[model samples]
Target: MPLSSAPISAPIARQGDGADPYAWLQARDEAEVLDYLKAENAWQEQQLADQAGLRETLFQEIKARILETDLSLPSPWGPYLYYTRTTAGDEYPRHYRCPRPVDGSHEADEAREQLLLDPNELADGGFLSLGAFSISPDHQRLAYSLDTSGEEVYRLFVKDLDSGQIHSLPFEDCDGSMTWANDSQTLFFAELDDTHRPYKLYRHRLGEEAAHEVFCEPDGRFFLSCLRSSSERQLILQLGSKTTGEVWVLDAEQPQQPFTCLAPRVEGHEYDVDHGLLEGVWTWFIRSNQDGINFALYHAPQTDHSVPTRADWQPLVAHSDTVMLDGVTFNARAITLSLREGGLPVIEVRPQGLPAYRVQLPDAAYSLYVQDSLEFDSDRIRLRYQSLNRPAQVRQLLLDSGEQRVLKQTPVLGEFDADAYVSQRLWATAADGTQVPISLVMRRDRQGLPAPLYLYGYGAYGASLDPWFSHARLSLLDRGVAFAIAHVRGGGELGEAWYRAGKQEHKHNTFDDFIACAEHLIAQGVTRAEQLVISGGSAGGLLIGAVLNQRPELFKAAIAEVPFVDVLNTMLDPDLPLTVTEYDEWGNPQEPEVHARIKGYAPYENVRAQAYPATLVIAGYNDSRVQYWEAAKWVAKLRTHKTDDNLLLLKTELDAGHGGMSGRYQGLRDVALEYGFVFKVLGLAL
Candidate 1:
């Protein structure tokens, strides 16, 4: 009985409907759970078309055991220019003939006719051409951002990858990510206004007729902005959230001024601007709230008036419990430091302040990144390893004597063996005693009979899910299934008290730490509860719909990708657009006591019928952030209050959005149809 002390089943919990604190979890609220999810959305879309025909017959028997096993899905971008999909006299039988990054020279087949074009001619001219480009230093011009749907918004175009001509962008809620300036003719991005919120920060000067506001984000608070630079008229901002922040500098030719903080609004601080020299010497990174006496690399030195002067700073590396920094490549006489320290990832260097030569990394979850440098003198170094049966290896090294030089290798499955599968990481405990962390992976030959498991988690925004290594999760651990991952709770890996014990009013401690990491792998013997299943996508699909509505007898199947189970009508809609920046990570559900603690985990208003398991949800009709009709009305009211014969699949996709697939063999055929519904609900046989 040690697996997180299990024991909550009083009809899925109860006891406090007042003294407020989430009515101490008495349950049933929010306009009677949005009127029982609007009266079971049309009988769960008619039993989700027979659970999508048993997930397309377990994805054509795992694509016929991955086409009778030869297992070669590589792709880390090495073996320059290689892609093959032909059937002899191919008269267009599912065509695939890509080939371009060659250098076996003789002018490498005319540099593959000037770098292989055709992304369907930029999607037949309506735009999507990011097919060829590279400029961003001080050259000014090179941009691309498309996704016409997934909830419709991202559009930015701009291209001059040396006069090719495009220049789109007409203004719309850009929603996060974009950076380039050092005279790359300005570009920085972030948009939201029209009351969808997140104040603008635009810029577009290749011809410009419109594109202003260099910063706004305020209305009712929420800012997680990001942008970086060191030249082209200075810039380096980070804004806040995820527990306080603030560190400005902006100046792109002073666009209305007011943004010179350089680290102040602190509150459980967190900074990082890394490289330096817009006005001179810089290299940031802080963590403080005090504990491990952080600062794993700092340097400042700009002075005069841009802030940052702790006597012109300089710390450069400190560790305890582990550093793990990874980034900060500078070099005029040394500064390398990639980090990860004691679990692998090396490359120390330092110089001028001493400390040198480290290197390591034969593989322990690897990565290097410093690509190219000469005048500033750093000399190559991209690396990027992969294990759990190797798949992505990307090379470049050279760094004085690491010598490797591959380039790209992602076959995306040509055959599959991945060292016959095997991985581990363990550390369970959950149900209050805390400690969770799993990892798993499978098929190293084990008769753990009911072998199907799947498990996964996201908890909430603090995002942690680490222990990287995958070839599309070795095509589901080469079939016999297994996968794991948990690390539960408002992640941040055991830091800020495991993300304040899992967010807002301690969000049911992230669904009781993902059911005590799936009953600690069915009590450590490995897999059981009818061979579990569980899965997560988007807030880990609202942590697998809050553990299938508070544990429906453990599991036998589930997946919720793109899930947020209409959490109390999406935090009581603040005119939806990332719902008022997720009211400080899920809370303000129009307050009647945070709408009675978000309708006690609104998995489409908690469907009942007792024994409900077999599921599959997917969604993405251009997901405007979890809204494929809230996983199509929670698989239409869990197939109208499911009781037994459970099975409620739903696919949707409808031309992707919210990252469903954008190349790479259509996201491995939608992750081999969600691992063929976790090997046909644990019956396993692919």
Candidate 2:
């Protein structure tokens, strides 16, 4: 591997107004900015040139563990059973369908498969993401959205399954979300503004020349989304901000009628509604957080075609201080409540009039995600379960008996053995005496007490970072590397209170909590400071930057992927896509107090002239969520300020966006590159 970097260029200054010297880098059309990015890319490639063999070895090791030609477990929907399959050398999965058994049974043995959609065909050797995949209620038509430029804007297309014919809408900035009315001829879709916010809702008739705007959320703080209720009786529209929301519903059968408000917007109150006869009445079952930090379940009658507020809601499940009611799903036979208790995921089932029971998984620390029940009236519910050392399994849970049968368990090929790994839960006390949870996994054959460990964290947006199994992670584990995830505050794992404690004015808690976790690992003999590596992406990348600035001596190296480091500048620019929408989460930086708080720890604003650790920064040229310039500008500032001969490299993906490289094979290559970086810095052999 290349030893260290040579001198790099300083950031380009924006001539006049702004406080940022690298503000000019955000100008996409500037040749000078492009040249700078290209130069950095060239430098990064040159630095890693000697690791080509190691990269390939890691890539092949990961590939060897995956079953190349495999098909997903078939799911029955209407008259068909749907599944996706990958060929030995295909870049993407091919979706296929077959008719279910004639006697209304979920049998696929006699079914003949029919090819429907192949992303490989649509991608044409470039990036392609399916934003929306909706089949009409009548099951006669299909509407799908595609974004091939990695820019996040998608175009909608409709297909006639019977005739195998297709046509596209004229929209270029569609939000890639659409729902069909009961009539099947009418479809509702959200439209994205120039800032990439889904601000307007539109209605289109199957054969119409144009779609007309039906509703527009003028407030940049809220985004509009719509979906047909499971009852298939109403089309529900929600306008949601980070902390406040409003709900509206229209009769699915009456497509031209205006949507009636279910609840008016109230600050500090967030709730979601669904159409169901939960109490043997046509009611709206709501998962709301009005009286408690952890949400509760309530049901309100559809009273005389009039809007009902919180006063009309009757509690079905009272809010509990220990349990966070994350979501509620209803069907004829059951009402499922997704919850998080004691920092772990739980699935609760309430059969019509029967007692509630939890669907238990075997693992001590694993993630449980409930899938949408394709057959809503059926007695069985489907869910997926996995952990850091376990491959995911799709299971069919029998609601009546509380027994689950595995429909399909993801296969890990070659010499993979689940019993050869150990997954453990550890706790680290934060500066404020709060115990942060850490999920860790390593090989059972390890001979050393302090192994080379990789610690990952993300503490923002109430988004939990689950300890998921990675086929590529085995490449590190087999070589005696351990991986752990710090479940710090700002994540939903421990409930709303945990999330609130790590966001806005309390954002510093996130960084401090992460540092505590790193120190705890060393103190417990899990890993030595020099053998430890830290990493996070996006907001988590912000965590990496802040902690590194505060205690650069705590880690051997770091990786920031498509990081959101220029927080103060980006959050202050209200014109940015997610800036205004995220006010409740990050606080409005325009306010004096909020501005000062953000500026205090915003990574780009606080870079100091000190010895820094070896770092690898990844960026995407077309990322709409976190702009590419954030990474570029931060790297430029770091290079100019840091007084170290350590490795600092920035690699930009020219063809992809926020999620980095697309396509399965290409994604593996990306992981290989990252693994190579870790190996190089830690001085590990391939």
Candidate 3:
């Protein structure tokens, strides 16, 4: 294959203009930008052509380790037991349901299974994602949304379960979230604006030709979403921005009535609402951050169905300086709280007449995600748990007796033993004397020996990089490579204070914290500088790009997937998706001080003449969140400035978006390609 001989030139900037040379790349739909992306894709393919066989082998190994034919535990909803299953070689799962047995058994009758939706069939050989899957109150119709372009714009569809017929709603450019009224015939959904922001709400009745506009959020900074209350009594509309938000509620029985505001939007204050039966009285569980950064739980009676302000809320769970209240789940008998403290997640159960108790886990560093409680009157709460070495295990907790039972642990086929891997929690001191936690996993046989290490991180939007099990990562561990996660200050690992120290004017802390963690690993004799590879995607990709620019010698190789490298330019343009709403996160660039601060650390703006490490950058053509041009422009700038002969490659998925490929097999293949690149760079390729 012949490579382009055109010299990569830097875009000229006029005096005091602060203009970017590669800004032309933002015209994603233009011919010049498309041609450049295609050329970059071809160049990457040719560069890695020798590793084609290795990629295939890796893909096969990953596929073989996964259980091809599997069924999820049936969850009771109304009169049916619903579950999803996948067949051998199928790209997607098929959702099915069966009538609950008269004896109230958990098992569903296989002979009477009713298929709700099969994504493979719905795709019809095209890209299709099920964004929202909702069943009507009567269970006679299923309302779902599909996004075929991978751009996040969804089309609503309704299926008659009993008649075996499908109806396509006329709504377009929806955000793919819908709520059904108590009547079951009326549905509420949110629509996206021209900038891909969900700002409007609509109501459509069954068999209606048009949907009526219910509410519109005039402010561009706020987004809207609709949800049905767990009690099935109210239709709630949530309006939110990065830091402040408000909620509105409508009587489910009166679908035509206007929504009433629960509380006015107050800057820097955030709250979320969920309804439940508390002490024989219908109550609203409101999680608010007004009193403390970690958030506090408050409850109020549902009197006269009037919206209560913060003044009327009574404290249930006081704010704790050490523990962050992640979320709350409610049922008739008790409430389950997802709390994070000391960089680990814990489930606290508060029964009606008993003191709160925390669920015990076996791992030092692990993740616990609260699953949806399908039935509001049940005495059990379900959660999924996983750690660095253990696969995901679903467990059910009996509220009354405080007994917990493991429902299932994902099966990993072939010669895989969890006991062979060791998981550890270590701390790295940052530049400002902050102790950053690092979760590490490695093969027990290779412990205490210097080996290649893959460090992963994402430190933005208060998202924690928790310990998770990955069968694909097993390939690296088996090859004497260790994996670790840097719980830096930008994430919510240590609560709100940690995240506050890493965003806005303090954004540089994220990059500094990541570098400190990398240096700590080297100083502790865990891995040498030449054997370290760092990886992250999206905002995390920003982390990788920043650290690489600051200390390229500390890492041997780097992988950035759909990276948001052109931060200054992107933040300057409010028209871009997520730019306006993210003002509270990265700070509004319109302000002089914020602009100067962001420009100082923006990866694309910071690229300079230096010896860079081997790098692989991946992009999705239709990614709406972090535009593909950011990666394209960053790579172009890096190539123009970096003085290294080390391999630098950019591969764009023309048919995908931010999430990459949609299907299971395709996703695995993408991972294999990434792993193959890492292996080649490390001289471990077969």
Candidate 4:
């Protein structure tokens, strides 16, 4: 089936000022919108119908690299060793546990296995996602939340582990988060309002007929969440927005008491608290941005339950303009601080009264994350480390002895070798003379040739895109392609100042930085204009759309997934989900200046008569973040105005949300589809 050559008709203009021509597409369930999406789906399928064999080969290549049957490292919690395992054909993992031995051995006893939950059995034939899974303090009961739809609203369920019976709680519109009390009978959860914002906290007893609403946030800008402290002595409730937040604490031993505020929320002041013992004193470690753009660590005594102001905060670690304080975790013997400096993550461990030291890593460009510690009193801490060319390795570090051991290194099946690949960190100078970081990885055999290059970027909301391993990307590298990541300014790679320079009035820096990186790669002879392809998703999708409009002749192809291209219209509507809360990230368009700024760059508003490279745009019908209409409207406008007939395709997943299709095998198939499209455009062999 050939795609229709007749261009889509121009959208019908509305009577209001700045009215969108394609605003009618926003009616998701309307017949016309559904018809248009179905047509696009059919066209995409027809265009790639000849590559069915290649898609299958790519899928199998990715599947072969993963271990079908695997077990995660068991972490000791209470009297049991808890872990999850996946079977060969199952779509979800099964949660299991065994009694912890007195000898302190970290081995699972197969004969003593106890099954807590099996999602494969629960899901039946429909979509199922397991949300909050937590065990009671006594370890006799379990509370979990499940969402059968991809919309993210979940229902609560409790199970008696000893009796092997499950009871459904009479709660609706839950946000899928639960924190258990020390009594083992009470649980706290957050419930979403009509707009799908978590606005209320409720407490429920195991056998109660109705749950009690503990607190409700009156302010629409702030969202609520609940969690248990690491020490297991306090229940913490948090209310926060993009730039500010407040924390409240309740004594776990006294469930009847109301939560006390730790500190009142101040506009533009953000802080998070974790309880820990410092020098034998109960202390609160708060990571706050009150004194610096990049946060600082402050400590306060927990004895007086009164709210402490900024004046009472005593600095534990002063803020550094070069480093962004990410978070802090605690154990009885030490405190672990997660920080980002020079676009790389580093972990520092400080013993109760000793000096601090950083965790050692082999690669300059790699990603690191702290795993949950099972016990508060234990000295062992777990960390996950991975690089562009290396598989993930989970390590256990002892704070007392400074000893580290690798618990597991994810296996990459078949003849895979890390030595055959080369990964490097390169710098590109932006137009304003600021240095932008780029992480590149490629097969050693393709270094000198002018091969195809895949550049990826996302520079919004201070989110950092760190270097990590991807098994599916190997298919491209093996096909003589070089992959690179441009750590642009809107990201937190270079700290808060970097993010500030790329957002709001200075948003053009993001597009400028990306263009600079692409030119740098070409100047270095890594790839020429016709051999380059760029990709990004969500906000990054906005980046791809903006850059494509700015420099259409600079790349061969582009991919934008769930792109937020209709920014001006989205920000103008206050009734949309998450619109009010996102005013801090993207300026409020109700103001004339902000509206003009957004209109100047919004992809849907900027389409013109120009030739564009081959492009693939993806969307989900159920995506709440970026609506499906945004992509559909943008594609319609492009067809009407684009000067050249470059292959333009749109693929919409009917049953999925923001993230594509669910399940491991299904996700692999989606990647195969994307890789197949890229291969077809690049003229690569199957």
Candidate 5:
């Protein structure tokens, strides 16, 4: 293993316990920092040297389960059908389109498919992430954005489909969002600021020499996002912070006109709007949290170019205390909503003149995602559904007849049986008597008693941690390992109130809830403390870090990927990417009370000189969110302070950012490596 040769010294960051000894790692550009990261990577490779075969087997298992040569369900747009194809041996999918069959068939013939963009060809064995892919309304041109360095600074480009001529735009940084005007000649995009916030909105015309700036959000806490309404009659620009939001709408027909505000910004109010035809009148449908913690749907009719105010807004869907209105989709013939009730997703559809009904799900704890249709009046809506034990299935629902058909089910290629695995929803009692949900999946046949279990969690930003199928997890499940997810309080699984209970000064609930779930799992004979393995990434990594500090002996091994461990220091620095915006989620540490509250659980500040479980942490050197230094400093501090000599390792991806390696193949490989580390520490055979 590599050891730091530089003289240890304290720096600016003052930990609650003492001065941070590893604060020097924050200087990312220093040669010493780079060398240390590389050394740590090499050390991690050596530490898992004997697991090469296990890693390979795990990788192969993951690869075999996935059908390499496949294509996504085609989506109908203007005059063409668009979809993506993934050929065997390719690291990325190829975008393609075909003319819609004149016979009105939902799917066009494969022979008529036209190639659009191939990431595999564009990447040329390097990293490439597509930020935006927008086809103009005229269908004569395509506008897209690319991020080549994984830093998320995308460059915009316009391509003439017929002439095959591509024109590059001058903007080097974008927020990965683009919208076209009714004229199709005017294109709108958002530019990122120095802090990586999408603060500027601009308009660029085809065949024009200059771009015009439309709007600029001066407040660091608020970022901008723009999109065309479903009616294609309104251009919407939304400025949002963590706890507050304000929406502005422009007349799509008059692209040069300024936008009008629907409501003034309120400190605690957040709302989103979309255009639709309500009762034959063009209307703005909004989902707002003004009336209740869970959002409610409201609509305001727009008879002309005159914008409507909050006074014109009328209730459409009343806010419910038990259900959360996650999102709303507007269509010509129907209005669908994404809702959550009892910690499960519910799709509520209100078709014209007909009553509303919730879509039935296959499992109690499954994942649901809606793919908004391009055609506003399309009668069918596409949705993707999956559970821990089931492969993802794409289904199309007919709004007119209340009927649905399966479009595609992600093929599990290798030998597999759906009945082999069982999924259950369980509840764990938190220390404060709150019931925390746990989604579990395990093989029906057990080879041993109280087998090894892999527990995962992420409890921040009101983001619910939903269960979904993972082909790679089969490697562990087939080897007698059970997997579970702790839907703790910080997550919005139950609703906005649940999320509020886990953040800010109440952040301790997130850690306590996680610990409670672990204890409950052990008490129920699902797994023993000595055979349990916990894992989380990003904010969830923060959860794991805090829980480990409070109760390290609860698990056998743990994995923290891109952890936000240095919370105190990061929040204190307002210039960081999300620091200012994060003040709403985690209170501003500038206030003494807030500082003490954060220091109470901010992982890096709270890490003690106590015994810790075998741990492996993975970080991305180029991550804009949760910078690499947090993980590096945390590991360095643990190495110096921990009393036990338990195995501790760090792996940094030199070329990737927060999401890790870009390609699908590389993503699976990363998972295989992480699982190999778990197998090595848990004494499991490949």
Candidate 6:
């Protein structure tokens, strides 16, 4: 069933004609509209009930399915130890202490069996849920932060491992990032006010009579610029201003003294400060409107009294074909550079005194993330790799010796056998000839007779959703439905070049990319227009809304989660926490050109009476990032404008923030709800 380019219905230029798409919709005055919404809501509630029932049955089925595979699963989790009280296998990894093998066996299952957390016989029992923890220089005491309530405020608590005694600092709110003072007698941490402003540095001594504020930045909007010295006696400050930032150096002992500015604020240039290995040597990455790219500067390695403002700073690298350095890791002899070159990742390990060595990973898919794991030392790096069907792989790479070992591999997906799973990378040219990357995944057993397909895309910011494997995604893979990702512009998948192609004025590329992906899927016998489903969350949800308006007949259903649909209006309101910070990301909507572009594509504002697909819009009640009302209004309008019979479901979570749940079973239940919808649409069993 190939789809043709011809319009499915006569084009009625106006939004609400008598033949208006929403002619059948029950308005607020109409009892049917309220009843219709009520009916759909009840149906969804029943679907949730069915999903819960299936979960109990599926858990056993999936457990058997997963264990039947040949892959090695990592004990299903890691260990957690806090002083004498140790507990591993909490619901979330961040909540518990990850236990390591005492003998460094690195066998997760064996280590789990050996490590034990004994229930204590004491009445006044307390457990330390480790947050950002650091060991003192002498290793006698350990300082860690833990969240007490709604806020992620760290309360500094010190534990004397030998005496099994814990002492609390005077401060109620402490910084997650804190380092011990040189003398080890004083502890330093930062604090933010109620307005979510950056931390002001404070110091606490073991026997101090009073807690002292060591330093504070003047503006509430600005953040702390404190960087500890090699001796920890002095602090380097990088004061952040609205437009730019300035660098300063201050003595720790002089609590209220003015800071000496090392680098004056550069107009239109965004600067970042990095403390170097040597004293007085700091690095700055500066991005400016004039330069059109970023540049790096290395300050003098040591403090020279005679030449305090020494221009001994050298230019290590300048903006070129590379978009910008994503991250930089420093070792004793070299600095490992991570940059996006033409949207692909390139890692360069340049020795300070020696030549640089470049290692390039294959570029067909995306790199989900590349982080230097603390488990390994300077010369060795642990990297996690992910792709469309390839579950994540953690590998350790040695820079000097050029040796690499696979530390861990995601369990082989039992639901999907590589031989039976088919995937392909296709490209579609937009109106501007920019080719969009589209990935499609299908089960070999699934026949191509208009089966339901689930497609996804995210084309905002330079955030690239690298192709990676996920075992959880197997829920969809096990079904006959196909899974897909649309690598549109605005994402860093191809790097800055691709991102620039889809942002602001050129934002149409994102919509076009999504539409193109859908068309390609239908054309390739994967699915028919009516059998396809598309989903995106946040900015990606914005994409879903745009395409639905343009081609509603193309999809069977849509899931827009925590979507940013009220783009045009939200951008104008600076009262939103991230709106001002996002001006550079999503253009200022006040600008004439930007205003017109956003108005044209803004999802909520552009709703029309058209034959639309069934839609499910989800939001979080406490979501400060994307307001709940945005989805509320969009659903309201969609109900009013739809031409034909279609279902629209709005689910709002009152329990959690941006991420839904804290418990493992709760999250699994959430996953089951979404997957159940797809299965029900595809006519699978409850």
lDDT for each residue of candidate 3 in 1-686, tens digit (9 for 90 to 100): 12352324322111222467777777668776777777787778778888899999999999999999999989998899999999988889999999998898779789999999999998876677889899998999999999988899999989999998999898788999988998989999999987789999999998779899999998888999999887888888898987897999888999999999988899889998988888989998889998999999999989884777778999999999999999888889988889999998888999998888989989899989787575989988788999999999999889877798998899999999998999999999999998999999999999887889999999998998889999899999999999999998789998899999999989999999999999999999999999999999999999999999999999999999999999988889988888888898999889999999998898999999998999999998989998898998888888888898888889888888899889988899999998998898888735
Stretches off by above 4 angstroms in model 2 are: 1-18, 103-111
Q: List the residue pairs that clash in candidate 4.
A: none
**Per-candidate count of clashing residue pairs (backbone under 3 Å):** 30, 0, 1, 0, 0, 14
Between the candidate structures 2 and 5, which one is better when assessed by lDDT? 5
Model 5 steric clash pairs: none
TM-score of 5: 0.97
Q: Which should have the higher TM-score, number 1 or number 4? A: 4
**By lDDT, who's the top model here?**
3
Mind giving the per-residue lDDT tens digits that candidate 4 earns over 1-686? 12242325323222222456667778778776776677777777778888899999999999999998999999898899999998887888899999997899879987998999999899886677789999999999989999876678899999999999999998899999988999999999999887678999999887789989999997777899998888898889999998899999988887778999888999999998888788888888789998898999999877755656567789998999888898888998998889998889989999887878999989989999898665999988899989999999999998866678989999999989997899999999999999999999999988887889999999998998989899999999999989999999999888899898889898889999999999999999999999999999998999999999999999999999999988888888877777787788889999999999988988888988999988999998888778888898888778777898788888888887788766778889989998998899999876
Write the residue-wise lDDT of candidate 1 on 198-306 in tens digits: 4566665556667677667574445645554422345666666655656677655553455666666646555555444312344443433323422356556554456
Q: TM-score of each candidate?
A: 0.31, 0.96, 0.97, 0.96, 0.97, 0.75
* lDDT by residue (tens digit), candidate 5, 19-85: 7677777777787778788777777877777888878888888999899998887788878988898
In candidate 3, position 71 carries an lDDT of 93
Q: Which runs of model 5 end up more than 4 angstroms from their true locations?
A: 1-18
Q: Judge candidate 3 at residue 321 and give its lDDT.
A: 92
Candidate 6 regions exceeding 4 Å error are 1-43, 47-51, 55-89, 94-262, 276-300, 304-312, 322-324, 352-355, 360-363, 366-369, 373-377, 412-423, 444-451, 588-597
RMSD to truth, every model: 24.7, 2.7, 2.5, 2.6, 2.9, 8.6
lDDT, candidate 3, at 480: 90
Give the least accurate 10-residue stretch of model 6, judged by summed lDDT. 115-124
Give the TM-score (vs. native) of candidate 1: 0.31
lDDT of 6 by residue, 31-54 (tens): 544343344444456545556766
How does each model score on lDDT? Answer: 0.58, 0.87, 0.89, 0.88, 0.88, 0.61
